[model samples]
Structure formats: C-alpha cells, structure tokens
Target: MFANIIILILVLLALIFSISKWRIHPFIALILSAIVLGTTLGLGGESTISVVLQGFSETLKWIAVIIILGAFIGEVLRETGGAFRISNRIVKWVGEKKLPWAMGFTGYIVSIPVFVDVAYILLQPVVESLSFKSKRPVLYLGLSLAAGLTVAHTLIPPTPGPLAVASLLGVEMGRMLIINLIVATFAMIGGILWVIFFLKNSWIDYDKKLQDIYKEEQTTTHNELPKGNWLLDIMPIIVPIVLISTGSFVTDNLSGWVGDALGFMSIPLIAVYIGAFIAVFQIAKKDKKNKVNRLVEQAITKSALVIMITGAGGALGFVIKASGIQNEIVQIFSDFPFLGAMLPFVVAAILTTATGSITVSLVGTASMLGPIIDNFPMSPEIVAAIIGCGAFCVFHVNSSFFWLLNRLHEVPPKVLYKTFTAQSLIMGLSGLIGVLILVLFGV
Candidate 1:
C-alpha cells in the first residue's frame, strides 16, 4: 500500500511536470499517466487498458451531451450580441458611480455560459468604458470583473470547470448550482469589495499599445447583427437552471406520469437542448437563420476538444481507482479526520498554481480525489465548494487570467501580484469560510 502511494505521488508529479514544464497537451499527459499508474500498481496491461476505456466512456456519457449543449448556447450568445446587450442595459441601469459593481455582476452573468477568457474578451471594452466613466482606477473595475469571472468559472456549472468537476464527483447539477451559488456569492463579493476598498484612490497606467487598441475598439465596433433584447437575452441562462432545479425538487412533490414528465423535461440534457433552441429562436427573431445554422456548427466544433479533455480526465480518474491507490489514501485519510475536508482544496490549489489553468486544476484534482473522497464524511456540496475555492486561491504568475489582466493595462506584474493576486486570495479564502459556515449549520 505504501509503495502504491509513492507510485501515485510520482505519477502525479510527472503529470504536472509534463503539462507545466514539458508542454505536453493535457489530454495526452492524462492518458499516459493513467496507463503508467495502472501498470506500475499491478493492474498489468489488459486490466489497465480496460479501466482507461471504461473511465473515458463512463465520464463522457454523463456529461458529453450537456457539454455540447452548453458550448452551443455559449456560441449563440457570443455571436448574437446577446452578452453585449445584457451588459449594456446593465451599464445603463447601474449608471457611472456603480460601474465597478455593474461590471462585476455583468461578468458573473456573462461568464456562466462563456469561458472566463472569452468572457473577459467580450466584456473588456465595457469594463474599460466603465472605469473611464466612473473615474475609478482601472485596476478596481478590472479586478471586479476578474472576480466575477473567476468565481463562476470555478464554481458554476456549464462553464466547463465546475461542470466537469461536478460530474466527476457524482454531483447532480441542481445541487452543485444551489450550493456553489451561495459559496460563489461570498467569493464574488469579497473580491469586489477588496478591489473597491484597496484600489479606490490608486492610479494605474495601461501600456500605450493596449490604450490604442481600446480606442480602436470603441470606434470600430461591429454593427452587422442586432443584439438580443436584454430581457429575453437571459432566457438561455435561466431556462436550464430552473428546469434542473425544478426537476430536482418537484419530482418529489408530484407523482405518476406528470411527475415523470416534469422530471424528464428537467433533466439537464433536455433543458439545455431546449435552451439552445431558445437561442436559435433569438436568432430567428432577428431573421438570421443562416447565422443560426452556423452557430450550431461552431458549437459542435468547439465542444470537441473540451469533451475529449474531459473524457481523458475521467480515464485517469478511473485508472486511479483501479490501482487501489485511492482506497489506500482513503484509509490513510481516515486517521486524519481534517484531511477529508481539506484534501480536495489542497490538491486543487496545487494543480491550479502549478498549471495556471483552473480547468486543469479542477479536472485533475477532482478526477484523482473524487472517488477517494466519497469515503470522507463531507457533503458533496461542501466538497465542490472546497475544490472551487482551492482552484481560485493562489492566482499568481502561472495563470493565464493573471496575464490577461496584466495586459489589459500597464500594471507591472509586481504590482498585480499585490493587487489582483491579493484579491483572488481573499475571495478564495472567503469562499472557504462560506463552506465552513454551511458545514456548521449541518448542510
């Protein structure tokens, strides 16, 4: 058992090294690590191969369609000017003095369907505009935006990171959403407030190049298609959540075919599928059928890589289970009661800090720890929150989001370390605190 633990540790290190230092694609590294783990741990060739295939297919079966639907919705929103419309109206409603708060909430909404980097890209102009109008430091609003995106990216479903983590941990989407939203609120508010207080009087300069690009973006914005109505724009985001949650809660209240029908309608796949068509309807209302067709194609194309990577992460997870190492660790953790609560968080933080990718961090840590963690006494929601918070903490040099924010303005990396990094750390810890509070209440 001790020997198996050492093997597990070594393979994990190798996996990290391959991604961080060797630049191996994560899909490839994960697959290779699974085989190596199964082989060294006495599963032998055939058994390991079976476990690999089993893991990949099983994991994908649960989430592949949901992911595709999610990607489809995100693509439609991106192409249809839906996200822009939502945020634009938000900007008007909140007005200038509240721009930081507005940008933060806009980020929280837009990023639910959109990737964090892509959300940042879609909203950057608005964030910049908000900062200028409000007369606030760029770092202030920028960090607020980052804060929202980071929280949703790590904690919310259908944005990939938390979605995949939820599936790997055997968590239902409804439960994940309910618990994570509460925890994410804590994170988002903490980040927004930190930046609000800290950078209130600070002045930061953008690089000349970024400043010129900003000026260019404002004047030459696209005008080819109509933006979705800000009111109708949120349908795609809300439909799935309402359906899934209703399915979770209402199935118990109603019985017979009616209940079953509602349950079927609420299943994530059907709900998201319906949401995609709602997105199509949005495009149809604009008389852009051709655009509608193209968006579906784009969603199919884009979801392919995410699906493959998620499947590979699953394969590695299954192989870890097959190796007996997971059981070994579970027993060891049994002796250290607190390990149950903190292990997932620590694993996630280490991987995110190492790889600079929250998706990878969430996937890798969840895949490895999910099965073993079932042996722990923590609730699934608490585990998910812990992982989400861990993934957000220590957002320093290794992260792409850090660099994205750095390039947004002329803020030196050193200064960002003090500002943006500091904000993420506070938000992450706040999330952890929120989870502990839930645990105290016996959630």
Candidate 2:
C-alpha cells in the first residue's frame, strides 16, 4: 500500500513536471504517464497496452461525437454572425449603464459553444469599445467577460473540459450539467461584484487609446455578416441544453414509450447532434447548402486535437484503475467521506494552476482520482461540478489565457494581478462556498 501511494505521487509529479517544465503537449504527456503508471503497478507490458487502448476508446465513446458536434455549432455561430448577434443583443438589452454585466453575460452564453480564448478574441473589440466610451476601466469589462467565459468553459457540458471530466468520472451528463450551472452562477455573481465595486475604481480606470484600435476592423467585420435572427442565433446552444436537461429531469417521471423516447433523445451525443444539425442552416444562403460540407470538415479538423487529448486522459484513468492503488486509497478515506469528496477539487485545482489548462486539469484529476470517488457524498455529478469549480482558479504567467488577458486588455502586470488573477482566485474560492452551500441544502 505504501509503495502504491509513492508510485501514485511519483506518477502525478512526473506528469506535471513534463507538462509545465518540459512543455510537452498534454495528449502525449497523458499517454506516456498512463503507460508508466500501468507498467510500474505491475500490469506488465501486454496488459498495460491493452488497458491503454481500452481506456482511450471507451473514453472517446462518450465525448468524441459530442465535442465534434459542439465544434460545428461554434464554427457555424462564428461564421454566420450568431456570436456577434448574441453579444450585441445582450449589450442592447442591458443598456450602457450595465455594460460590464452585459459583457459578462454575453461571455457566459457565447462560451457555451465557443472556446474561451476564441470567444474572448471575438469579443475583445466590443469590450474595449464599451469600456473606453463608458469611461469604465477595461479591467472591469474584460475581467467580467473572462470570468463568465472561464465559468462556462469549465462547468458547462459539450464545452470539452467539464464534459471530459464527467466522462472520466462516470458521471451522468444531464445531472452534472444542471448542478454545474448552479455552481457556475455562484461563481459568476461573485466575479461580477468584484469587478463592479472594487476593480472599477482601480488606478487603470480608463484608456482612450483603445477607441482607435478596433474602429476600422469592427466596421469591416460587422459588414461581413448581417445581423442574425435572435431565435435562430440561439438555437444551436439552447436546443441541447433544453433536451438534455429536460430529459434528465422529466424522463423518469414519464412512462412507457414516452419515457423511453425522452431517454433516448436526451443522450448527450444525440442532443448535441441535433444542435449541430440546426447550426448548419446558419451557413450563408448565397453559398448554398454545399458549403456545409466545408464547415463540417473544419469542425472535424478543429475538434480532432481535443478528441485525441480526451482519449489520452481516459487511458490514464483506466491505467489508474488497473494499478490496484485505488482500493488502498479508498480504504484511507473510508472514515472521512467529506474529505474524500473534496479530493477531486483539490487535485484539479493544483493541476490547473500548474498546467494553465483547465481541460488537462479536470481530465487529469478525474482519471487519477475517479475510482475512490464512488459517487462521493452527494452524487458523482455534484462532485463533477466541484471539480469544475476547483479547476477555475488563479491564472498567471504559465497560462495562455493570462497572456491573452494582458495582451488584449493591455493591462500592466500589476493591474492584471490585482484584477484578472485576483478575480479568478475569488471565483474558485467563492465556488467552493457554493458547493458547501449546496451540500447543506442536501444536494
């Protein structure tokens, strides 16, 4: 047991060391780590190879199609101006007085389909323009946007990170999505408050230079795609959310073929496929339906790397199970179930802070910590939410998102630390408070 404990610790350290120090891609690092873990634990070469392959294939069976479909939805939204429409509509609805909040909300919605970094880049001009014109600091607006994106990017299903976590942990997608959304709301609210009251008054309060930067580009880009229909714009995102969430909640209450039908429709893969199919209609009419093939190819191309990484992460989890170490670890936590509950979050947070990739963090944490996770104190789905919350933490030099925040927002390191980094830490800690609050309510 002691030897297995040491082996687990060493495997984790090596994984992190390779990712952060050596800067190996996570897909490769995970595969190598799984191989090492399997063999070191006496699975031997043949069994280790078999476990690795089985893990990879099984993991992808859950997420590959969903992720591919999601990528398609995002690409369609991006190309057809749906993302732009959503942001613009939110800004108009919230009005200028609440521009920061609007930016945050826009980010939350858009990020459900779009990648966080990509979403930020797409919305950067709007954030800058609104902040400068409203005489608000870019930090206030940008941090709010970042906060929303981070929450959705990690917590929401079909976004890859949380979806992968749920898959590796054997969590039900619908239940995890519902709980994660609630926890994410808590984090979002906490972030908005921080930006409004505190960071809004900070030294880098306003900048006029940003006004000139996006002026020409915004006009040219806005002209490229007409304003999309509001309902049409939101369909790709809302369809799956409605279907999966409703199915999870209502299917069990129904009976006979009706219940069976809802259960089948609610499957994440099918639900997301419906959304992606709807997104195809958004392709420009002038180019005809034939252009969709191009978009499909693009979506597949974009999602391929994500699918690979997810598969590798799955292999790592399978290897961990094969190690026989989980039984020993489970024994250690048998007397303290709450501590066991918190383990996923802690592990995920550490890995995220180290790797600067929440996808890798959640995947690594779930694969390694999943066996003993045994439905946790409440439910594995809730634990999945907790893991999502934990992975949302302090981002700094190591993170590409950190550099993007600095570069795009043009905030000095001091301001970046006080604002973006600080907000992320608050979100993670406040998210823990949310989990505790939910647990108290018998979640």
TM per candidate comes to 0.93, 0.94
* Count: clashes, candidate 2: 0
Local distance difference test, each candidate: 0.81, 0.83
Which residue pairs in model 1 clash with each other? Answer: 206-410
How many pairs collide in each candidate, listed in order?
Answer: 1, 0
Q: What is the per-residue lDDT of model 1 for residues 75-121, given as tens digits with 9 covering 90 to 100?
A: 87787688878777776688667877777888888787777887888
lDDT of 2 by residue, 149-267 (tens): 99999898879988888888887777788888888888988888888889776645236576555453344233344757868889899999889888978887999999999888899
Using lDDT, give the best candidate's number. 2
Residue 348 alpha-carbon offset, candidate 1, angstroms: 0.4
Off by over 4 Å in 1: 207-227, 284-287
Error of 2 at 7 (Å): 0.9
Best by the TM-score measure: 2
lDDT value, candidate 2, whole model: 0.83
